[model samples]
Target: MASPESRIIELASRIAANTKKLNDYLVANNLPTPSFDVKGPKANLVPKQEIEVQAARAAIIDDTQELRRLVLGPREYLMSYTHNELISQQAITRFGIAHSFPVGSEASFAEIATKTGLPETNVRQVIRHAINKDIFVEPRPGVVAHNAVSRLLAEDKVIHDWVGASTDDLWQSASQTCNALTKYPGSQEPNETGFALANNTKATVYEVFSQFPERARRFGNAMRSFTEGTGFELSHVVDNFPWGDLPQDGVVVDIGGSQGFVCFALAAQFPSLSFIVQDLEPVIRAAEKQPQAIELGTDRIKFMTHDFLTEQLVHGADVYFFRWILHNWSDKYCVRILRNLIPALKQGAKIVINDNVLPKPGVMSKWQEDRLRSMDLTMTELQNSHERELEDWAELFKLADPRFEFQGGELPKSANLWVLVAEWKGE
Candidate 1:
């Protein structure tokens, strides 16, 4: 019998096959091949509906990553693990380095330094570090030019906001997480988190950002960018849920719904369903003034200002929905928020949650799984909160009230978050 192929060779073969498949699809459709160059496509070229193509792409990603680690071997791979991966990107975002020069124009280190108010050597160091990450390019000695990534940073305000908020706020908080744990071991209070320690404030992350309007706006804008991502699109929630099964006049109360994006998406999909979007006074006031993504028919959707941490004010709504809200709070707070709805709920009332659900280890590609798990830790760093397993989610409702019947959850196909449901049995 022939000897079995080595793992490296197997990976290489798989990568080659997938690359050819993706390339053929792109070429057949006259789409531009993937590139890091200045003129690469802004959005992912592969349509989400192209399931086989997406699988091929994912296979390539997983194989290449595994092959890379295999090539590096164990000790070298361990040594290659980086802690300051975001430092260069953070410096670039903080200094507005990408905006210092216009896209399609090359600038020398000194020119960039002058524009950014940094020393020439400092500019060179930052840009050179970023270049290695494909954010920019040095075509020739001392000449810096835009790549697709850096150009996107220049052109997209929301993308810039993501990098800025990520590096400045999230990164700083993550660095202090160990210290927070050391100081307040096993604390579940949001204000006792690394965010508070890093910012030197007793307030939660939300409260800290609320104190700085521009900072809050930037953080909000960053979250907005996430909704535009393939995994977090509001369409995922609208398309896969059982909203059509409700009564013709079924009501949905969006707890802590910021700007009503989820409601807007759902309303467009299920016209018969009415929505009440509840948030803080400032958020509701701002959302009320702004035009919605979809036109709301008369009385189809209402905006109300109410903190979710307090009692739920909407009585007898069919579905009390939370999209990406509960993960920010500890179990104690989450249970409190759930119990707050008890007074308003009727028999067979549903509580719908749209949030990240931690998966079984090794069930997904390491590349993908690592990102999700990092987010779980990110919750800890920022708010002393966390992503939940399916059981953990069920446990919350049980802890809140025995009448809450956990109806279980299912992650939508190709979507990063899961939609979970519980029905309230009347007392």
Candidate 2:
């Protein structure tokens, strides 16, 4: 049997070959070709064609960098320990769907322009650019198509709810880093300065999402697709997590759980356990509209409107489940959020956090670490947050409630993305 490294090498070689073939096709078919010119100190005196070529090359590099950050970095981090079946599901989310269908397969650029009242040329150019990055596939010249991979983006109620929750919308704000620095010099450090510029007054997540509507849906859908098939992997691990040992039975408030996807999954798996999904009002509406989730039974699983940054409405839940929430805020803010839960928790209440923990050097694959680090940066840039280490999290827990100590035991494998658990103590 070929070693995994050998298989990866083969795959990389195949990807390179296919890239060359695609490039050749673009050249032969009169599509836009990649420019070769590289910018240099002496480029100011260069010819117009060379300058344009250099600019084009630079744009390609920037786009490649962003794509790598999103796909190879964060996506790979989630995929490393996630189930094998979710790869295609996540890949399809590269294209934002209007009604859960791949945007490319739904209609032509002309059709989109007509629907959105945008110019046809602009729409076509945008779609073409996205297609080049494999966000959408063009089966025939000027005619895009969809495959099984695109089905994850289709108009499913569950998919819609999931998409609304996990997407980021600060890419454009982050792009203005240089402009912000040049306009107003500040005493704040570089990272802090950037954070202030991106989101000082507007810490409200929903307001930020509203500002970047399209981007919010895009990021949310991408994450939702990523979690679809991997649900089983998490379910398998969480299902046996000593639920019976809990001191009391109260609501499992899925705090910040938009649309109740996690709650529904857990409730179905453990029928005896009741769940309450607490999120923003918009998300609660979306979750309520999720017919499939409703079929699971409203008695066992329900939705509640709650915001983490503000007051948490839940009280005395046996467990508070936070999946991929704290990573979006700075350590200080995370503590504030966690501290807010203290008043609502009963004695021995458990706090289960599901997020990617960065693996140390030589502990896991380099590719996986690289992905986590990139997400660390992305989260930092967009959300003014950092991915916390175990120690950092322990500190947060202590800050939240001195009475509760971290349950020091055998740590979950670093490979598992959703693999961190902490517990509360009674005085």
Candidate 3:
């Protein structure tokens, strides 16, 4: 009998096939090919709406990763261990090396050192290390220029904030997570987290950020950066949910909605539905000045200064919405957040959530799974919270209140966040 095909060969074969398919699609659509050059596209040109083309691109990534792993073998893979991977990136963001020179111009190590106030030798070492990761390109023996990645660091404020937050906040917290866990075993308080430990404080990350506006803005923009990618698009929420089914005068109270970005999108799509966006005073103040909020505030969307953890104030709304919010809190706090809404919830009112839903293991590609799993760990590291499966969402509502009739949810195709709705069955 013929032996089963080897794993590496199978992966390589799949990689080649998918690569051809993706390339064909790109060429057919007049889309540019992927590149690390400064002029290259910042994102995959294959649109998420094109399922076949996007799947081909995704398969190529998964197969290539698997092929590399198989070729590495177990011992060699074990040899790849290290914890200092974020060091150069940390230096880059902390020192603002990406901004030390013009994107289109080349800079020598000494020149960058002069601009960023770093020792020339250290700048040379850090940038050379970053070069290996494609952050910048060394065009000559002593001079460097921007690649697409480093160009982004210099030009995209949100992306820069994301990198800075990931390096300065998340990486430090990650290193201390195990130590924090060991010290405070089974702790669920947000203050009892790696973030708290890293900051050498008992306060939670949010509490710490509240004391520093610039840092908080960076963190906020870091979160906002994800919305630019696939699945985080507001269009997914607008298109997937049945907002059209609401009564002509239906109201959606967006609990903890910062900047009302989601409500702005929803208000545009469903003119029949009005919105009340509630957040803390600072967030409300910021949202009130945003162009979208200014435009939408005319008749449909109203902004309110409130906090989700406090008693919910807006009463008898048709729908209450939470997007990218609940997963940041531990189950204890999530239950409380839901309970706070009970006083405001009308009979037959709906609590609709747009958030991450952990998939069953092996349900997604490794690339996708790694991202979700890392996010799960991050929630734990920062807030003692965790991503939930569909079952967990059902159980969470039931635990919150018996009247919160737990309804099953759906993850829209190619979208990262799921849409779950639970109806209040109050008599």
Candidate 4:
């Protein structure tokens, strides 16, 4: 086995080579080099579907994370990191610091303080801390300006909402998570969450949001930002699945499908496939009003109020699809949801799920794995639920019913979500 120092050297070489490859790809494609300048690339310019670009990006992420781990060593890394960075981020978002500075324009600390209603001294300290994190930049001494990251927070409402929701809602819940855990050890109830504790309410996160319209809107927009992200695009689902193989005018029931976004994408590609987007009454009403859904023709794609927790209402659909839904519920609840569909499923009917599948220990890149692990914890915090491993998912099907064949899962290239399918084998 190679020494730790030798391993570090190898990782560094890999990082350098991959960085060069990514840079060369960008340059060849006439894209701007990665920079924090306000005028830098508006978005990730590299198409995720490009195989070479994806490989280079993955290499950079894996090697850089490994190199950092090796350099920091185990003990120093574990002990040196602090939640102070999260606090700094919370302060920045809470105070509207990003919104205080105009894009491409610089502002003094005093000016920012006046705009944000924070003390000038506090603004300087907090913003200086944020500057170190590459959120904002102090271009000249005492003058702060929008970097590319900060500019997005100012200009993009969805991204701004994401930051706001993360700092204000998620951070508070995370702070109280330990207390909740201590109070109700091994609890599976959603109302037993830190979110409930933080808000001084026994309601689940969703129930609490239902009472606060503004908070709910911001949370929705925040989720929209995730779906609009590079790998989370609905096009990935449209392209990867063998939807074309289905018979003409086949029915696809989208359980818990919000706003029929995925259905719209599917309708555009597979014109012959019809859809039933089912959700709660409020969600169904809103989904019906979506211009994209209307434009795609309601005749072909219809919205219906149907709760998945109860019995599945629409029977014999070619596919019963669940996108980013099951992870919000505990295994017990997920099994219930699956069992509810049995009465409705025809023999050979498909159940398609698009959601995260946790990697086995030490298998994924540290950078990517950190995100998945965080999501797992987030599920616990919000709903006493979790992201599942592949085995866990297969077991879920088996637990639901023996007749349900766990056809397994596929992680589509350039997509963050896994596509898992099962078929109803029947008695």
Candidate number of the best lDDT: 1
Model 1 misses residue 371 by how many Å? 2.3
Clashing pairs in 1: none
Which tens-of-lDDT digit does each residue in 1-427 have in candidate 4?
9887789888888888888988999899888988878888767777867888767887788887767777888998787687775666777778888888678888999999899999999999888888888888887999998888888888888888888899889888888889999998988888998888889889999889999999999999997787777789787688777999988889999999978888988988988999999999998987798888877777789999998889998988899999999999988899999999999989989999999999997786666788899999999888888899999999999999999998887998778999999999994
Tens-digit lDDT track for model 2 on 1-427? Answer: 9774465455555445545654555566565544311111211222223433334433444444444444565667566553323323232333343333343345666665665565767556655654554434556665555432233334354553453332223343444444555654432233443434656542444455577777567556656566554332456436535665654445688888877777776765666778888888988888887885678667788888878877666777788888778887777778788878777767778888777666566474344456678777656555556787777777778877787677632334322455556777763
- Clashes (backbone N, CA, C under 3 Å), per candidate, total 0, 5, 0, 0
TM-score of each: 0.93, 0.57, 0.93, 0.92
What's the ranking of the predictions by lDDT, best on top?
Answer: 1, 3, 4, 2
Candidates' C-alpha lDDT? 0.89, 0.58, 0.88, 0.87
TM-score of 1: 0.93
Pick by TM-score: 2 or 3, better one? 3
**Cα lDDT, model 3, residue 221:** 89
Q: Please, what are the lDDT tens digits per residue for candidate 1 over residues 1-427?
A: 3233388888899999999999999999999999988999876799987999988998898899888888898899998878868988998988889999999999999999999998999899889989988899999999999999999999999999999999999888998999999999999999998899999989998889878999999998997787667888787888878899999999999998988888988888898999999998988888876567335843888999898888888998899999889998999999999999999999999999999999899898677788889999999999999999999999999999999999998899878889999999975
Model 1 misplacement above 4 A:
1-5, 268-272, 291-298
Candidate 2: global Cα-lDDT? 0.58
